[model samples]
Target: MIDTKKIRKFFPAIKAGRIITNNAASTQVPVQLLELLKKLVVQYDNVHRGQSHSSILTTEEFESSYDTIAQFIGAPSRKNIILYRNATEAINAVMYSLMTEFKDGDNIVTTFMEHNSNYVPWYGLCKEILPKFGINVEYKIVKFDTETGALDLDHLKSLVDQRTKIVCCSGASNFLGTINPLKEIKAIADSSGYLQPNGDKRSYLLIDGSQLVPNTYVDVGELDIDFLVWSFHKMLAPFGVGALYAKEELLLKMRPFLYGGDMIAEGMVSPEKVAYNSLPWKFTAGTPNILGTILSSQAIRLLMDFSLNPGKQKYFMTDKKLERKDVKKAMDNIEVHEKILIGEALKILGDISSLNIYGPKTAANRTALVAFTCKNKSPFEIAEKLSNLGIESRAGCHCATLAHRYYELNPPASCRLSFYIYNDIEDVRKACLAVKKCI
Candidate 1:
């Protein structure tokens, strides 16, 4: 078991007696990261646009931040990582960058289990924007088993044909709390011999890892995914930073999502010809979030240190390069801890007769969240009552509208209790007991 007492001390929210069980949306920032933020302010300056010593220092930190993030996900290098506002924006960036690649006969395949951020952008691409231009692209959604919350692999396989351009899926369902079989999905995508602009003959796979990456180890290289997106805020950093990881070749061939300012190569822009900057920077336009970038990277470092040696500061506020084994060990520990917490939550909440839980019944098959609804109580009312009892919970589709609707929930919402590294068994008990009281 993880040292919850030691872990709780790092987060002021836990100390303040707030039972923070809504971690799927965003995690509370640790005091270490807060302190790092303060340190960054004194040395703050815009990166790649100044000559001051502070600018140079901040620039190095910001750039190295990419390396830290890339290494955490087992990406090849910083070239594969692009920062965005959130996972939603990161996925949209992929849509925008690859917008021109769609053809008249092409289609995209997603699923009913996706968060709206993953589904709506494709919906707009195929149904709205592409149709307006007279491009006859289609978007197909695969279904999951209503009872099991498992993806219909056969249905997913049937949706991909030679004309399928891209396959979008969530790494884990935020609402259903199911961990998808990505390698199986990747195999299905690979079998679809869809030709691409880059001469590739398979559908590109994009995993919306907003939920997966924060709770488990996600090696982009090992998974062999063409693209992956997630947010730092979900992993204990403050808001305003997210990440997109794509293959180096894809980033090289795709169009830049945004254009202006520093994305252009130094002294390479003119009326006659314009050139873009190298690799990751081409995707980052204008003034980037330098301070947030630094803090987010340090957040990963701090998480590693916290997992490996709780309450100690080995990796945070240091310049050490993260080792691959350490990343695996830290993430594995986190995954196990979360499994235990979620298992206990499922048990406690399952005991309530009127409460209908969504997603995989086994914690081994799901992420660290439990989303459910009580038959006689509206989800919003239950969530409000839980709040009154000083317990935190989320009520809504939790942005997984498609999944919520798939379950045929009236008003289409659920009450969710999610746990993180700092959350202990006691917190889960209180949240579950409060849920019982609310019902």
Candidate 2:
């Protein structure tokens, strides 16, 4: 199956005797991506602003990076891709762009299991921002099953109605580790007969794919999502680049999230009026993270290569357009590998007396992460002890405050261990055994 030995060589972190299991926050960059970053720095320049050869070359790579990201996710084209600082900012962009569109009586539906990035934006929009403007748009949160950590689709259906303008949900929970059924969620969102300015008869679906995109293959066209957001750091790339993929039609009609130079068409501005640039650039305002964007795109290529040919460099540096089948094959292999790792983690950690695991018990129902709480043991203390044992773990709300409150956790915390491509069965065993030692 997966060559863990070969894959571990690409990441220098594993060689340094570091057990990097806290991957849900951010993954370590491979040596390949680090080299790519080094190569990009010499010729770096601001995109769309300079006429030098370096500018043109860097712009070419930067723009092509969008194509790579879009192709990886099965988006139609680069026109549908928009770059942001992170997934949170991308979701906020949607909220601001559609702020004026929400009527007084309309409501937004989201799940209780969502990361704060998804929930807090809508909460601020409906409760804080819109209220000051005299708009009373309501935000309704659907509950989940506490035992299984699964979204209650019936409750979601009950929450969505004709007045629901948007439905936002996470593709996977960072704390609970549950992979939500997006297609079924889309079906429910589509049934909401909310009239929009674009003449659409259903609510728009926005998926927070920060966790799901890194672990599984996501096809936006097939899923019929209006918007999708994810961060590159969670994958193999470094920080400072996240992606937003929306339908071209939606990007064309919706207002620009940020406005500045290069967003306007050349020479189309006058004292009287100004015209905006075309599809993707209109959304990209000021200077972007050129080096980070290139590395992020190359990270996708490297991930594909790693999945297909573990130790080889078949697709990493190539400029070839990524094929859909190759993406599916690579993601499927990663999914299977992660499932085995998480399954072992669940088995080993579940053996500990009084340790309660969150999310689905089966590996198939969740991503490659395990969060748990124990009786009479503080999660923070457990995490600290695991750290002393050289086992990396996260202990906090994990940006899932609502879900922690839902479970009635006293300190609003749980210990989590998440895996990536470089992690193997041994890594899971050590992390779990460390947890056992802590308890």
Candidate 3:
């Protein structure tokens, strides 16, 4: 029921005969997003904390986008959404806050499947602030059965304990498209995995929602996550913006990670005192990508709505929701078709005697990503060969070194071909042929 024909018209990259398959690295921009971005740039002007007409309009536009994005992900309100440059900034906001909240002997829990952006900062904090608090940084550890490459969930549960203060995790592995059960993870955090003699929850759960929003509906309230981070670029918005949604109490306690301009209402850091703003602007320093944020709203409006239940309509998050029924159905249908196309590609590529598919066997357990290693071919070699064959793919550790170890591919792992709404059966067929030719 997905009209790939009509849908294909919106993405110029897919129509260019390039056969793009590197959406995991970056998705091709839709004409909808592109046009919106173009409009902003053409109508460009500076925006800052001022009373000028242009600044007022621009600031309003930027702040308004937060509401749209909040709605897109079922956030409580625009006030809870903090904008940033990318997932890294969004993750940093939470990481720094975690640093402020915990003391020695407190613990933090995460997995190896996290992108370096998610992994490195926490580790850095563990080495820095955790020591002062006598806190131990524990991990669920990223491991896989070299044979199956499935998630080691049992191992994950073992890592949570009485002292754990934070549970931050990626919603899906960017490398292998492995979808971790956020709902289950949230439940575990809510109850601390029955960690007590009678079982009392001990950690606040945060989700790195960058990858999940594109693949499915993201209702943060439904997920009951304490914090969630997502970048606009990954979700088809401009690259300069991302959002961090956190619980109100946590936000109140957070010391500003970055400080300057807009962050302070009245400043008197006169060698003796430092004053700050009262609201969310405490964390926001200086002028932002006001135009980019404005245009991001336009982009968010243009994306597909993943919900289907008509009765669940009241739970819809957007203030100006995309009222078009056809677009939502088309988006959902496109996702279903893309899954099938990617699955067929997996079926063909999975059997190549020379190739080793890492991660789940069935596509349902994963997002629309398929990664594989070959007998002796370097990941870059395969990726280059596929590129020469007019197919697009990405290679190397994929910022997922743990995923590399999962397949016993240490230095570099496999090539990844990620599918999107614009990708169709022919594109998958072409990629399959390209992979076949590589062998």
Candidate 4:
């Protein structure tokens, strides 16, 4: 029910006669954001370090950007939000911030379906960092069902115990396109009898929402999540900006991941002691990505406008506070639209006998992406052929090496075609037919 014809007009990539279906890796930038970038270049200035008129104006936009991002995800406030280079850095921030809190026998529980960003940091922490300090921390990886691509919750329950410090999982699988059951995962994390330094009796839950947040609505307060990380690049903005939403209490207790200028309090540093800045700022170090932050926040507003009323400026470039109802409606529309697109894709791609599709069989249980391997064709060859046919697709592990290895793929790869709001049914049809033709 999304007016894809109208939505496609906002993207230059679509107008260039190129099919952009590689959205799981990164979405194409909209023309509005491009124009907004041009306008921002005129008055660009470093925030929080200058007294000039341009600096003050730019600082206001940069700081208000936090408010917009916080509002979009139903975060309590800007205090709980921290901006990073990308989702990988955000996850690393959590790992580093809580590095010292791990006990000798503590374990971190994660899934086999996680992207490297979610798994590697914990791996490095347990294998490389903690052992140097004589702390014998362990990491446990939960398994998923190979047939349905569903997470094995019973196995996750068996892995978690009193010693489990944190539970990390992806909100959706990039390769399988599986939308994980977060509430169920949260419940499992809560039941773990791990006593925390903060007097909590459960493991902290961190969700890597790089795939989920961009495609669906996520409310931090409602979910009671300890940490959430995602990249704006996958959500329609340009690269160089990612987000971390943690509980304010947890952010206050954890150490800063990076430290330098801007993180320290103004005029508070002395030879004896140096105090850090307030919440959110404490985690942000050095000169931040000023223009990227502004454009990224504006992208959220523009996305709502694109879903609700295309070619209209109700939310974009405005200072109005985003209502929770409007956010839900906008995201619900997107989820529904994606279901239709993925449903059509599943129907067409399922008919190919040589193609073996991964993830949920139905659109209701997954995101708007499909990854498959051909019986006689290499995934790389299929992707190259699709590119030659004017279609965009991704081939490789898609940074999902663990999942690919789980399936026992020799090259540990698959060809992926992902859809976004701007992608139409015709695009899905052409892309699937092209895959059939390629194989």
Candidate 5:
């Protein structure tokens, strides 16, 4: 069995008696991940344009992170991975790229269950200027039954049609904790690895992997996703860093969302002779977040292989030593343990007549996130009450406004308690106790 205690030991945030159940909002940073950020802040001063040894070394470290994360996700290579400020920017990059062909009549199929980060952008893109570009974008949301969050793949098939251009979805929902049926959805779209005169690439299946990346080893090749994005901040990395993965040829086609220096190969003051930078850099203008990227790299490396502790430094990069199967097995083992904890929590919470949960009825189709509602208590009030009891939980809509509306939870929202690989039975017990106190 994977040693969860050893993993939990690395996250000092658990020291306070608060059970941090809001992992869907933000995860507890492990000590190893924190140290890498500290090293970047404490020692490194250069970002992007530094020419000194520290700058060069740190740059190498930052660029190396792109490769490490790319390899972890099984991307074609690091070149396809471009650094952005966060998942929002990453999403914007994809939307901005689509500015060219999208017209008023064309529809984009997305879901209601998306975090605002995913939902709002498409909404804005569809509403704001799509008509000017001739695209009348319509949202075909996928909501689940109150009994379970088994995503409506059948409903999705009905929405996707000849006019549909893009299908954006979350790799995993942040609130309901439901894994989407993307591959199945792709099959409905008739989107297979199609023949590209330039290269092999199918239509788009962009996954917002923000909530799913740190917990899962997602092989991009296996999924055949046309695009994917996630936040480094969520993945035990520093803030201000995220990734946008696109087929290089597709990246070559999209327009830059923002314009500034470093994005242009050479541009003129006048429009007479403006030259945009080639693939990748064409989208990323100005100086990049080098330090954050470096920190993110180190953090990802540590999570991928925890043995690479900073000072001790001998335990990491089993990239060669340990096969991907071993890592998946360890993660799988931990997932099984988490499922047990979730079951215990459900059984305990179900006994309380006032309490209710949203998502899959069992752990079979669910994730670590447990979203619930207590009668006569605002979800936020429940969360605050739990906080006072030293139980850290999430309240409000959990950024899943669509789910809030779909579940008929109304303005009060639902409480979310998510666990990572590190959590044990005791944490579940504490959460149960805290809920009792809150009630």
Candidate 6:
């Protein structure tokens, strides 16, 4: 179990008595990251564009940030990692980069539970962009069980055929809080007899891990994930930095999504000929978010430290290599902690006769978030009332618009309360009790 009493001290928001239960949208930044930002600002300089001491130092830190990110996700190396403005942009990068690879009759498979970011790009590519180019591609959406909020694996298998080129799925649903059965999904994708230019006989798998990576352990190598994308803000850092992890071979073959300045090799751009930089950098065009990248990487380290040893600095602010065993242990602890919190929340919220909670009934089947609707109250009204009681809650579709509509929600919205590492049992009790009071 996490030492929430010690861990809560690191967050000024908690100290200020604010109930930060809306962690699914974005987690609160810790004091260490804020302090680290100040130190970084003093010596900050543009990376890879200068030859001064500050530039050299900043560049080293910025580049090392990629290593930290790659290690956290069990990526082979930094070559597989690319930083973006956010997860939406990172997923868009995959769509754009692989745009030319889609054939006239190929189809893309995704789920109704996806955030608009994961679904819309493919929708635009298949319905809008590709059609104009005389390349007709189809986008198929998998269905979920409305009652359990679980993906319909049999339905997904039926949808995926030889014509399917890529399968894009969310690692976890932001609204339903359902942690998808990724292994089963991967097996289904693997069985698709879609031929690829890379000589693979299966459709590619792209996981939108925005909700999964922040709260659970993810091993890209073990999962054989072709592409993974997530935002750092959802974890613990300030906004503006997201990550895309693609196979090195795929990164080497796929064209860069953006092309400009740093993306090109040194002295290789001329009127006669132009050559792009090596893997990863080829995708990182123009000036990147240097400070945000550094802070985001530090946030991963700090998250590990917070989970493994609260009120201590074993990984944060250190140059130590994160051990795989430690990563699993830290993340497993966080998962267990969240299960307990969500379990308690489910029990309390379930007792409210007027409310209907969405997603899995048991905490073991979902993440730490709980989304629900009230019979006598609108979600917005409930959220505002909860806020008046100093409890933070989010009321909306939560970006799982298709899923919200799947439930036939009148307004396509629900109120959500989510927990994180710094949140304790008391926070969960208070948030759920406040929801009861609001209703």
What TM-score do all the candidates reach, one by one? 0.99, 0.99, 0.88, 0.99, 0.89, 0.99
Where does candidate 6 have its weakest 10-residue lDDT segment?
Answer: 430-439
Which pairs clash (backbone N, Cα, C closer than 3 Å) in model 3? 103-133, 104-133, 104-134, 104-135, 105-134, 105-135
Residues 1-98, candidate 6: write the lDDT tens digits: 78899888888899998999999999999999999999998998999999999999999999999999999999989999999999999999999999
Model 5 worst lDDT run, 10 consecutive residues = 306-315
Taking every candidate in turn, the Cα RMSD to the unseen true structure, in Å, is: 0.8, 0.8, 4.4, 0.7, 3.3, 0.8
Model 3, 162-198: lDDT tens per residue?
6677787888888767778877776666656324222
Report the CA-based lDDT of candidate 5 relative to the real structure. 0.71
Compared to the true structure, candidate 4 yields what TM-score? 0.99
Error of 3 at 245 (Å): 1.8
Q: Each prediction's Cα lDDT score?
A: 0.93, 0.93, 0.70, 0.94, 0.71, 0.94
Residue range 270-356, candidate 2, lDDT tens digits: 999989998799988888888989999999998998899988988888888888899999999999999999999999988887999
User: Which parts of model 4 have CA positions greater than 4 angstroms off?
Assistant: none
Clashing pairs in 1: none
Structure candidate 5, residue pairs in collision: 103-134, 103-135, 104-134, 104-135, 104-136, 105-136, 307-315, 308-315
Query: lDDT per residue, candidate 4, 362-408, as tens digits?
Result: 99889999999998789999999999999999999998899999999
lDDT of 2 at 189: 95
Model 1 CA deviation exceeding 4 Å by range? none
Query: Which digits, one per residue and each the tens of the lDDT, describe model 1 over residues 1-439?
Result: 6788788888888888888999999999999888888888898889998899999999999999999999999999999999999999999999999999899989999999999999999999988898888899989999999888999999999999999999999999999999999999999999999998888899999999999999899898789999999999999999999999999999999999999988888899999998999989999999998988998999999889878988888898787888788899999999999999999999999899998999998998899999999886899999999999998899999989988888788999999999999998999999999998888
